[model samples]
Target: MQIYKNLLLKNQTQSFIDDKKHEKIVVSNIQSRKNPEDKEDFSKLALANYLDEDTGFNPLGITAYKMNYFLPFAYSFGSLGNDNRKMEMKFQLSIKKRLFENLFGLNEKYYIGYTQTSWWQNYKHSSPFRETNYQPEFFVDFPLENHSFFNNLRLGILHESNGKGDENLESRSWNRIYASTAIFYERFLFVPRIWYRIPEKRKDDDNPDIRHYLGNFDLNLGYLGKDYFANIMLRNNLNLRRNKGAIQVDIGYDIFNNGIYWYLQYFNGYGESLIDYNRKLQRLSTGFLISY
Candidate 1:
């Protein structure tokens, strides 16, 4: 079993007088996970969460699914202090694929996904609550010049279920479209991204979560910086009717490899889901990695 980790420590200094605000305290996480959430596999925690001398896997990341798969599972975790903690688990799987193969209107992408997030008392929520989401989606991807420019383009629709309650929850689905283009020279590359989500409101009087729509764009750059090794990313986003969104994006530099090697990263602004509204945008994290 391979493992990875990303750990970061924030300066204790507070940006404002409100000590309760998220300033100070270390931010650590696993950007991607290779393993699922199974009690028999708590070992995944060492690599998925933080540095745990006992666990053998990398401190970050979990095993992810393959390309043609409809849904994807993403893993991440963090804590402001020993007492304040948060954890999340997500499962996304593809349903209908290669439908009609070449049929234009009949061919479509379909998927199902669910997510659960929990919080523990420390500084944030006094009582922890779980938000659940049920989603069905359709998408298409186009391949551009493989080694040159515009290697791929994609678009899709996402149906979201009510997150507040289990039963009273209503199914809230929406249509979303996204496009990606990349230019590559040797190992260095740059990719551009654009996406829009058209959320529909529910007429049901029982509707508790208000639905909304949004548009966002992002650009990323990658450099082979060196042969057999490359690193670079630039991403930005804009949400309608909300403050400017922000985030930190970068991977590790595994140049120096020794016994017990590790990986690390720092990110804020923009949560996991490109559509997450309440996710924070400031934090630092670092941890060891395995197998690079």
Candidate 2:
């Protein structure tokens, strides 16, 4: 939720105009006399279509997944007070798709998404993987036009686990139901989200009091700069007596006018990863991202 708001297709939906009509609109200020059909034609056939159109085997409703990749090289100075573990590497790959549109005769869209993040101890002898977090979620997005600031709302059910069972007693996992809405103001975007964790059986509960560290709600703020993007994520439990939370920052700049960009990130929190869910961590990293 760190403002990964599809930058590659930022202007993908721009209205199109014929050569003659375009000249008149630009010169005569007759913008209201544009062709609606031509606009739709250009929108659907634009370069962004190649990246988002449903082209693969769609045995079911319209389904298309877009790749979101982030690969980073990191170094942690305060490694939770551990030695020989300061230098590390990390990567995250995410994919999401629209499964169906206009569900149950309602103008709502259903989507499925998955994200995987791996933490590697690349400086070690074996270069072992410290931990990997896997998250899969299903959500419904509803478009809104009533308010000028609010544009979209979403509700989702999420499952996140480290995939480590009895092997690691400290393995982390959780199930949540969340609601989110996006507010847009010019080039600024803000999203606020709240979630409720589902109770699990005592025997299977890995981190029962995770809400204290991971928090129950999150807020994201984003800004689209001239040639770069910046986002900040904030989380808090909203407990007056025992306040706890996390913060993450990300900045990315397009490189070579391409889809790929140079990315930089910093995180200071209690739940940075599945394995380190209960430990405090401060890390900084730089990498490349291919996002849309």
Could you tell me how far off, in angstroms, the CA of residue 73 lies in candidate 1 after the best superposition? Answer: 18
Superposed by TM-score, candidate 1 places the C-alpha of residue 50 at a distance from the truth, in angstroms, of 29
lDDT of each: 0.37, 0.72
Q: Which ten residues in a row have the lowest lDDT in candidate 2?
A: 38-47
TM-score of each: 0.44, 0.76
lDDT for model 2, on a 0 to 1 scale? 0.72
Q: Top TM-score: which candidate number?
A: 2
Off by over 4 Å in 1: 1-83, 86-137, 145-147, 159-175, 202-215, 224-243, 253-261, 270-276, 287-292
Residue by residue across 23-135, what tens digits does model 1's lDDT show? Answer: 33312122123122311222232222211123345334222211111111122454433443443222233223232233455333332222322222322466332333444
Q: Model 2, range 32-113, lDDT digits (tens) per residue?
A: 3243322222222222322245454556533323224455578775764434477788888876777778866757878888
